[model samples]
Target chain A: MTGNFFYFLTFLTLFAAIGVVVSKNPVYSVLFMILTFFALTGHYILLNAQFLAAVNFIVYMGAIMVLFLFVIMFLNMREDTEQHKPVLSKIAAAIAGGILFVVMIAALKDVNTQMTTTAVFDSQIGMVENLGKVLFRDYLLPFELASVLFLAAMAGAVMLGKREPGEQNRF
Target chain B: MSSASNAYFTNVFIMNDIPEVIRTIPLNYYLYFSTALFCIGIIGVLTRRNAIIIFMCIELMLNSVNLLLTAFSSYRSDPNGQIFVFFIMAVAAAEVAVGLAIIVMIYRNVRSTDINILNKLKW
Candidate 1:
């Protein structure tokens, strides 16, 4: 039953991810991406990483994707009129992408050693308590650094979004 | 030959008794699946011209990494990877905040979200 569940969740994730790539309309793509994230959250739950699953839903599905939708709606451009990349560029991108995929697969062909073994944790381990303990102990510096980086990004976004007084007439 | 066959049977029996399917599959399968998803995301980001779709692809890639990290954490019997996944989530949130704000500002100027037109910085 669990195997079937994993297969189902994986199918949804892969399907939505493909939709994200193939959808021409930005709104549709964002919606599909949200579905993909939700399916991934399901996978995280199945993996017993309950906290990660919740965070995945809250952060990606709730906040980030809504921001994306707002930007799309605010632009309010005609989807049919949106300019696409040149045909040559598109072909080049495809070739480059294909080559990269081939190289990556070939690189992983020989290294077959297993990096980890199955060791299920206690239920409490994936809860907030264990996560907080480790975050505050072993990962303290990195966690703090992430917060500082977020602050910097916020300041940068404000600076970038701010318009000059005289620049309004140029547009 | 007979002794080796007996050992293989024992290993198979041990695997069959794992109560949870998550405990049975090799960790490499999860890692490889996530890697493929990440690769797909990368391809999407490179091939798509729409700014919003590009952002979505970036998000996809990040989620792939999160999946791999969580799987590794579970396999190793450690919660550190899960904690790291939390930090990654926070960073992704910040990224979306700043990325969309800039996209909105760009749209205000050009009236379009197509990335090919935003070549003002080209010298």
Candidate 2:
């Protein structure tokens, strides 16, 4: 049953991810991306990383995707104004991605080692209690730095979004 | 042999105590799945001209990495991988915030989100 659930979520994730790329309309793309994120959240839960699942739900699906939708709607890019990349380049891009995938598979296929279950598996390792202990202990410095990064990012976004006073006439 | 050992472990331990997903699905499957997802993101990035779509593809690639990290973290019973995944999410958020702001500013200048139009340094 769990395997079935994993397969289903995997299918949903891959399908929606492809849809996000294949859809021409920006709105449809954003919607498909949201779907993909949801499937990913489900996968996280299946993996027992419940906290990450919630964070992925809140951050990606809640915040980032909405921002994408807002930007798309704000731009009024409903029409297919994008000139498709040349057919040759499109094919070349597909081939390049395919080659990369094939190479990675070839290189990694022989390195298949199963996870050893002997090392006292802590089922609660993914829970917030254990994760928070690790985060606040070893990762404290980076955690604080991440906050500083967010502050800088927020400032930069505001600064960039701010219009120059006399530049309105140029547009 | 590994399956027989796993069965012994399950019999000795409570059924629910075992990591069912990890036991059932090989780690290689997660690796392969994430790799495919990453490649799809690459294809999208290479093929798409719209800046926002490309940005979305980049997010897709980040997600694939996050999935792989989570799988490894779970399978190994290590919390560090998930913590790294958390930080990656934070960084990605910041990146999107700044990147979209820049894209919006470019659109204001060029009045289009198409990447081809913005090629020239000085408009």
Candidate 3:
């Protein structure tokens, strides 16, 4: 049952991910990405990482994707008129993607046999209490650093979004 | 072939009698699937021409990594992976903010989001 569930979720996740890449409309791409995130969240839940699944929804679907949709709506991008790139580029991309997939599969071939029997960890470990302990102990510095980066990114976004002084005509 | 069947039957017995193994299988499978998804995302970013699409592809890639991290944390009897995932989430949020701001600026200046058209930096 678990194997079948995972197989279904994996297929959905892959399909949505591919849709994000192939969709012509930016809005559709973002929407498909949201679908991908939803499937990923299901995978997380199946993994017994319930907290991560909730965070995945809150962060990706609730925050980032909504922002993407707003941006797409705000921009109102017209359809592309330029001829699609040559067929060679598309073929090359397919080949490159195929090669990458093959390489990753080859790298994991050794581990496949060893991993046939799944190893179970304590469920309590994935709960909020345990997560908090590690976050405050070992990973605190990087956590703080990430916050500082966010602050800087916020300031940079504001600066970038605002029009420069003396750049526009005054009424 | 008998050995394989024995292992399968043994696993079935263990899974039925011991639920822990059943739970673990899903996590392992998710980790493997997420890794594959991440590879696809990398390929998309490397090959795509539309700047907006490229940015979306990067998001796809980031999410894939996040999935793997989440799975590993659950598998290792440690929540550190989850915490790390939180940090990654924060970073992804900030990245989108800055990335979209830049994209907006580019659109204003070039009136197009085609990456190939932005050749001013080309020597």
Winning candidate number (lDDT): 2
Report how far off residue B54 is in candidate 2 (Å): 0.2
The CAPRI quality class of candidate 3 comes to acceptable
Instruction: Give lDDT tens digits, candidate 1, residues A1-171.
Output: 777787788888988998998787878888898899899988888777777778888888988888888777767745685667777877787677667767766776565534333333354467677788888999889988998998998898888788878776443
Per-residue alpha-carbon lDDT of candidate 2 for residues A5-57, written as tens digits (9 for 90 to 100): 88999889999989988898989999999999999999999899999998999
Candidate 3: tens digits of C-alpha lDDT, residues A1-171: 766777788899999998887777778888899999999888777767667778888988998899888877777764573235677887787788778777876776555322244454356666667777877889889988988998999999999988877666321
True contacts kept of 3: 0.49
Q: Which of the predicted structures, 1 or 3, would earn the higher TM-score when compared with the native? A: 3
Query: DockQ of all candidates, in order?
Result: 0.43, 0.62, 0.44
Q: List, residue by residue over B25-77, the lDDT tens digit for candidate 1.
A: 55556766776788778878778878888888888888888898887676555
Model 1 residue B112 CA deviation in Å: 2.2
lDDT of 2: 0.89
Candidate fnat values, all: 0.53, 0.73, 0.49
Worst 10 residues of 1 chain B by lDDT: B1-10
**Model 2 quality (TM-score):** 0.93
Residues B1-123, model 3: lDDT tens digits: 223323322333233332243343634355567667877787677666777778888888888888778766654455777887888888889999999999888877676677888877988
Candidate 2 residue spans exceeding 4 A from truth? A169-171, B1-16, B121-123
Best by TM-score: 2
